[model samples]
Target: MGGASNDSSSSTTRCGVFELSIFVAAIVSGTACSICSKTMMELHGVGIDGTMELFTKPIFQTFGMFVGMMFGLIMHWAVLVLKIPFPGYEHTSALDNDQRPGYNTTSTNYGAIQSEKDQLLASQASTASTSNATPVWMYFFLIIPSIFDLGATALCMMGLRYLDVSIYQLLRGSGIIFVALMKQHVLGDRLFFFQWLGVFWNVVSVILVGATAILNSNDDVDLDPNDAFWGVALVMAGAFVQALQFVFEEKVMSMEDAAAPPLLLIGMEGFWGTLLCLVVVYPLAYYFPGEDHGSYEDPFNTYEMFMNSNTIQWSFVIYFFTIFAYNLFAVLVTFMLNSIWHAILDNFRPITVWLTDLMIFYVITETGDFGEPWTKFSVVQLLGMFVLLYGTAIYNAPNAGSLKLEGQWYSFGFNLRGEYEEIELEIHEEELNREWEERQQNFKARRTSSLAERSPHTSIHTQALRGFASPKI
Candidate 1:
């Protein structure tokens, strides 16, 4: 009776207090996390002109993200459609004993899932292999995410036009905050207090970033017509859609073919994303393009819409290679961080995007073209970035212990323990029982009278008999 009543009260408290906040937060956070991939990729989309201010180029990074997409449309279109190249091989690697995994938590599947993610991330990070194949049907899965991606990309471009690259990047970094929020609400994830603190700090950093942009606006160049309205609107849209993808990707990561590998998925996504864009945008853009598509001379030109490069053009070739390389880069790095993480598709092409933009701007000036000088970054803005970095570190505290994994060669998930997954929630019955039995044995092994009396079956093993049990996210 006491247990039942307690359960009832707990349920009421949970329902009455946490639901709404979690949902709202998840929607916002998910969008931010999803853009991590997009942002990295964005660097490859738009090429920079020496005449433009690096910070001033609104969507330069975004233009870079889809470089391959642009190239595919212009260069690889015919070859891709016909399926001419067929390697017909699935590369396999022997796992070192170090690569073995274990399940050590209430969420029995967590360790395994993470292990798989690590493997996938490794493939994504390195560019040794090449493929000319794709699962064509994958295009169908893209509609939902692509709609959201395009919407978000549009918004990112708009925001850039009104703001500088540094400011826009800082703002975009807030997507992680949104991720935390989504985890709480949409995913019903419980957050540690420190994680919340990290989220708060990150938010403050974004505000600082915005302030920096506004302050830096003292000297300005010409604004394209309707750029602000459209850019801002698209940015907001991107944020919203990014949140959507964060949740969706997490939910899908554990499914059959999904958990199978990460690099393959990244490759397929780029391939299909490029294909879909080509199919939808090409005809409307090239042959019967909307007035918005602009002219042929503008292919690799604008950071806002499409590139000015073409199939046979040198700039066009460079653009595609850059995009592909960075997409691979971003996918690999972020995968190392978290599979639940997003693929923003921006920030992938360049190291210091704003810096590059500025260099380009100055070169354009040296050529006798008028280029603007950028004197920005207030003290407050600098501090804000520092705070943001701090917040990111704090928020990642749960996984901070794994920090050594960064940039380490042997650290490529060589050792796995307590593995689990996001979408594929079922735990094997034997596995669960084994865990329970192990816990009981551990308790007995400890032989602490007081601890043993507290209920020996309390570990995940107690839940073993329950079929299809999923680990907590």
Candidate 2:
């Protein structure tokens, strides 16, 4: 037993260490990706003296990201083809054998019961029809997520042009609000009181962050309030779109027959995204006039700039590699740990990006040439950051013990029917009644056995005493 316990503890420790190392890699890669992307847009060429920002093409940046995703797909295939022993390498079964849990018919409402039954039947039917091999037609469902990804990435890149990296990162917290709302309506996931509270705090954090960005605009950095407002709007809109993508991906992946491996799904999305950018997004960017006639996105000009600039070309390469690494690490983190851990990692990413931005601006390039400089410190921004982190922590907290909050209050649900809880209560009451009856029966049996063991005279006398005590009843 001692040896077994020791082995278990040792295994857990090693696992923890490995996960920690992966998390660190994820942070580094993610931070590097963000900084590289921002630098590509902001950094000037070595000899070019004009104010021409060569990499101001948000559409091209989006295209590069999809290309990176394609590379990720290739890498995934390579691992499979080589039979490499990678974590999360095994694909999920295309069909699930286990049926969905049934609702408590005694306590549940007719409507909810019927709905659950219908869903269960549908799932069973699908699973029964599905073969071991994933259907080719199901792969096309990935296009939906890919389209959402395109919108989200393009909008964010466009917004990144107007905002600081820190602000851009901070504003992303708003996505949780959209996700929460979508989960409730689209996925039928009900939020507990604490989660709802967390959502509220997240909203407050976003508002604070946005206000700080607008009010504390740095004149030295040529920060405009109007531009900042537009940036916040764009980033928030992108976050909303990204939230939709997340919810849709979850919904699709949860399906019994349609589920695909994470890497394959990402790869498919990338493939579709790249094709869409080339055929649709790029063409639209070329023909349609933007804010300043290609100032925002001109595919032809982007091509020219890419051809002429070595720095731009190298930045794109770095961006591609970093994006791939970040996605790979992210998927690993999610597979090894839980969604809560992934969320925590995401919360940490902004801090890493913010600190790296400060280092680059203040220590590495004191002239604001390589990256945007940190604006004058604001107590509000600092407070908002803390609040944002706190809100995120609250949302992802595994239990009330983790936050030292009242568990009952935190877990309070607003479901009017309370069907599930009622079922549980009924079961508990039945168990208690059964145990009480068993105890009474045992007591009577013990008394009867004691009487039987007594002598006949003693038994008669005891019966006579019981009869006298019963008063002729």
Candidate 3:
């Protein structure tokens, strides 16, 4: 018993360490993606006049992200076609059936039953390998979320043009508010009192962050107060749209027979997004009139400038890889750990981006070549960051009123619930046991009924003996 306990403890510690590593990787990659994207937009090029900041093509930026998503689809296809061993692909149906509670695998007929099950599974696998065509309805079903993603990303990119990367990250917390409201109305989920309080604090954080942007607009020569306000509005609107996407995606995933691999879903969305941008969004932007046609997202000019500028080219390349890496790591974190851990780590991403922005401004680029310096530090902005973090923690914390930290030492020394893992294990075991009991009762009833039909004059004791002797598979 003691040896078994020690082994379990060691295994849990290893899992915790692994999850923590993935969490850190997710944060770093996500921050890199954000910073690289901003750098691409702020990069300057030599023109007829002088050195001018030329890249402000939000639509093109969105298109590049969709192109990166195509790689995810390619990966999914490679995995399926190559028969790769990937996480979340484990087939446990036979194992689960064998391990059912009170089921005797040592029976005389157990070997035959197991062999037949294995043969059936192998036949199904062979059939699936020969015909792997995806259903057409899946493509149509995924387009809904893709449209939402396209709109959200385009709006955020447009907003990013006006605001600093740090502010943009912070303002994204507003999506929690929209998600909460939607969950209540659409999903009929009830929020605890603490969660509602967290929402209120999040609202305060958004207000504070927006006020800081407007107040410090005069410090930067290029930033206009009106533009900053519009940027805040645009980001908030993007957050709302993104929340809608999240809710809709959840609904789709929750439906019966609608489950798909995460990477496959992402790839499908990328396909639709790329198609829409090329045929719809780009054309509309090109024909539509704007106040600053050249400076704004003019795709024709963007293509010309992209061909000439190596800096812009390298920036986009880095952005593409970092964004893909971030998404991959984020998905891994969600699968390996839990959504709560993912949310907690995500709240820290804005802080990482902010510190990286400061380092770039003060240490890397002293001449302000990359972008405008974030030299002016506001106390209110710091307060807003803390408020946002606290609110997120409150919302994600398990239970109500108070927070309890419990987990393995390697799980960052804290989890939302004290007995979360143990409780989940116990509940799962109970469910399995109950299911097994029901199946046993049903099987006995069927055997008894068949015996009665076959031999009407058989005694109840003889029927019982016969049922036990010749157990049905």
Candidate 4:
């Protein structure tokens, strides 16, 4: 039983290591979803009237965000309150299963009931923790990052109107630099020499890409040098806010109890973020009407766009649904991985979006023969892409180990190498020693009882012989 138990645990850890690929796919899917929404806005003319409607509509854009948040809220309730499992995510701790007492996973019906009952207990415990009157300031602190995140996202939407999604991804790549600095200063994280080199490379690549976009506009798409400059600036500003949001999220998650439901926490952020955006959207609509190009035809047209046009209304439905699913997946990844790796994984966004655009153009849209900013297939852009890839590789390389890539899922402390095995072996040895000692003690007790049982019979036989000899005398 002990050996089987150890084997089960080891297998679970191995499965977790394998699950890394699934986690990456989820992140990529979420990123692609968001990129697709941005592209739709760019194509459909979300910023046409300088209003906020999606694809040149302002009211619909805000509605889409709200609708997405609603989806997030519903998912959180289902997972955290209703105790329903997320499809394809039924195994949250495939690698780090802690088999608690009363949790018998071997039986389907009874075990499921037990698991749900335990989950209810956990939920009640979390509620009790909240009822203990957590400091109001802590709640505010938790919420501040969500506001910054929303602000950054708004800027990103506006920037998307001017810059191609690929270039915008390149510009936002500088997020690694800010994240590194903040990790060092605010979180007391120490980077190794290679990690710092990676950071340096990231900075250089960002500069290369940004300069290429701004100075060399001939082969680039719709961007003049002037527009490119401002677009890059807005993206950088958004990246800055995004950096703060990442750091703040890390801090809040760290402070949360181990038993707390991460999705619930994320849902709270989305709920509040949507409310905050409501307060900011009107002023944003007035001031940012596409920065001189997409001025709104009428102030009330933001609302009128949905009521008047069926196509626009359907687009909102798609946009909101996509954004909702994206957030759910992204938030799960965020909770499982730290913000650092989260940002790192996001480097794939540009490549994914670029490929997606290529597919769309060649098959669906049938846009003009691919060239310039529209296709973003120019040699200079390709060079920038290579640089970005190189930087990301250098940055995520193992910290201080041998050249052999030692993969570790830090969230669960599971390692893919024999190092974890070595530790487990030591533990197995200790268990064996304990069992051996118990076996020896049990053997000695059995031997002593048998000897005692024979001694009484032997003494009686000796006494009978003595009596027979005395009677003959």
Candidate 5:
């Protein structure tokens, strides 16, 4: 009876292990959701901004998007030739798996639930388990974050008119703390104590920086009606949107079956968003005219002819480069975060990628460009960087831990010769493990049916260790 019970327990554990593997697969594609954010930002910033004048202006965004993508493709090709350093590969310890556990795979899912109940249940069902019905709102949850993110971008850009970069950074950095609440309450994931500490430290840094900016500035930077409140509102909205996106993706969007490829989603998003904004904003501009009636550019300069006409001031070139660097970074980081096995650990890898863009932006500012970097580093400003760093580390820590707990989802930590090679090896490993486990179960059943109850098999012990073991050592 005892032997029979053990077999049942082992079968249950095997099922759970399979379910977790699926969850990890889904989480990997969650990065595709960022296409929605990117599309929304461009729509509001350029599409909706000049509103009405653009209708006669020609549907240029579609073309501009294609052109922009061409540039991105060229850059990607160039980077391949240049062999640009991808940051994650350099920093991640190849031997972490080998050093910690004894598994052949210690690098798979980052947020594997540690509880036995979750594991067993996960093995038995798909993501939409009968125990917890998926919230109906989940269908539109992705859209909610997109709207807020666009709002944030517009607000921050507008806030820039009134506030200095230092002030804006302070406010912007504060967004992550809101994320901690989302992660805990919405996603129901229990973060480590240090992770909370890291978040607190980051938020405190932003507050301190803002206080310093207020104390030092002799004048308040205020803007016109169109620019003031709406700008601030947008950025705050963006922050909330960002926080919401992370939580929703973790809970609902990150599933094993993906709906579309990254570029396909990005393309559709850009096309739809541009069309929708034009439809909504153009009518409003027609009757309740704002910047729509007459744009800053000349009358003949329709959106269609804007690029060909020499109407683009040299100053806008500076802006284009800034956009070029920032957008490129944003798009690439999104791709990397999506493609990886344990994105949850480096959860805010997007933030780090954004900061790198900011640093590049600072250089543009320092060269007496349209952008300006703040000269004096207040104590608060310095602390914000530290907090950001710690927060990123804390988020990533659990990813490693999760992989340690679930051995079924391990990835070869070493960088492969090519993307195809990497994928093939990963699949091969999974198949072999499945066969290995089946054989072991068969051996155990044979031993039991013969009625000689045996001790725990060494192979079984080793296999369990492999689930938790490090890949490198």
Candidate 6:
């Protein structure tokens, strides 16, 4: 028993570590993908000048996103319909059957009857699930959030085209403030004083970062300052829209009888989102290419351009696969972990993005147009980054201040084993045994009296055999 307990504990610890690692990897992969997308834009000349039209647009990123969503939809259905388990999980039916009420079986063929009843119950549940599922029309509501999600993605991609990876990541981090505020207002969740303070610090850091950008605009960063500000604006807009999308998703999930598993919900959103993007954005990307300037000329025929430029074509393929993988990782993380954990992981992303970008740019080859290194950040910007980090730490920290302390090492949250006393409920064994014996004696006496009063034809020994009375008595 002790060995079994230890093994179980070890298994639980291993699973926890595995999940944490997966979440961290998801964040890193997402940051890496974003950097890759920006590199593609730099290589392809999509974000160079605001007014220039290009014959070839950066619509490949948009198409890649659509394909990723479609992939997600297909994977989810494969798991659900095919009853295949997701990797790392055991194969089991997605529809829970254990909660169904058990049927009583009192005959000699109880096992057969129980088996038949279980099958009937399973069939009934599947039918009810199909019949009572969300109306097809209500799926249109899902399309709304998908549109917002796509808009956010497009905006972020645009921002990446103009901004450095570090600064762009920092700016996107400010979106947490929007999400927090929306959660408080829309979900009726109250923010603690520290959380509110974190919000204030977040806002201040954003302003400082923006100011730093303006001050350093004239430097030989190679990027136009005006375009940098435009990137900032686009990121902020994307963040706000993304926040709205989150709230909208929450509202939809919270609706009565609309409760669905996260996998299915995400799959549906991806399906609708892909359809909407293809219908609205696909044609616009191809036919109404942006106005042309020297490098910014719209490729009215993207297919022709893709086929002609080997570099662009290869970049598109990489972006396609990377974005698809990123989305899958994101959904899997969300499915396995709660949103708060996801948000906390996101808050930790700037550090990872900064470190990753620094290593990639400084250690690896520099492709001139991917913006400046981390060393180019202004002193004010560094301070602002620290302030933001501090605020986030405070916001996420446990409410340890409320814990009562007995000594330097002693608090309500934990106890020192040496000084702590074991708690055991008092049990009077002697009294309990006496009461139980008396109850038994009384019960036997009643049984004796009842047997004498029973029908003359009934056998007392037969009644005892069937547990109607104590046999020894």
Q: What lDDT would each prediction earn against the true structure?
A: 0.40, 0.61, 0.63, 0.52, 0.36, 0.53
Of candidates 4 and 1, the better by lDDT: 4
Better of 2 and 4 by TM-score: 2
Candidate 3 lDDT tens digits, 1-473: 01111111111111245556777898999899889988887876544333464687789888988888778788877866564544322222221222211111111111223345455644654454333334568778898878988998899998898888888888887887887676666555454445666677789999988988887786767779999999999989988887777656544432323334456667887889999999999988877777335334567577667777899889999988887777667655544433333444556788999888888887898786663355455678889998987787656544222243445462345454534344345435645664686477446434532212211232332222211111100
The TM-score leader among the candidates is 3
lDDT of 5 by residue, 329-351 (tens): 33333333321112222234333
Judging by lDDT against the true structure, name the best candidate: 3
**Candidate 6 — what's its lDDT?**
0.53
Candidate 5 lands at a TM-score of 0.45
Write the residue-wise lDDT of candidate 6 on 361-410 in tens digits.
77776664343465455677787788777666545434222222223342
Q: TM-score of model 2 relative to the true fold?
A: 0.70
Residue pairs whose backbone atoms clash in candidate 2 = none
Question: What does candidate 2's lDDT look like per residue over 1-473, in tens digits?
Answer: 00111111111111245667788998999899889988888754332223355467688888988888877677667755664434534321112222211100011111222344345644654454344344688678789989998999999998888877877877876777887676666555555555566677778878888887787665445577888899999999998997777666544443443445456667888899999999999888777767534434666566666767888889899999898787667655544443234445555677888888888878898676765454465556667788777776555444222232343454344332343333335445645664685466445434432212212222222221111111000
lDDT of 2 at 89: 40
Against the true structure, candidate 1 has what lDDT? 0.40
lDDT of 4 by residue, 14-78 (tens): 11332355456655665566555565554332333544544444333544565475565566557
If ranked by lDDT, best first, what sequence of candidates would result?
3, 2, 6, 4, 1, 5
User: Comparing candidate 2 with candidate 4, which one achieves the higher lDDT?
Assistant: 2
**Candidate RMSDs in order:** 15.8, 18.2, 12.2, 17.4, 16.3, 14.7
Candidate 4 minimal-lDDT segment of 10 residues: 464-473
Can you tell me which runs of candidate 2 are displaced by over 4 Å? 1-24, 45-54, 91-131, 218-221, 291-296, 332-344, 399-402, 407-473
TM-scores of the candidates are 0.50, 0.70, 0.73, 0.66, 0.45, 0.68
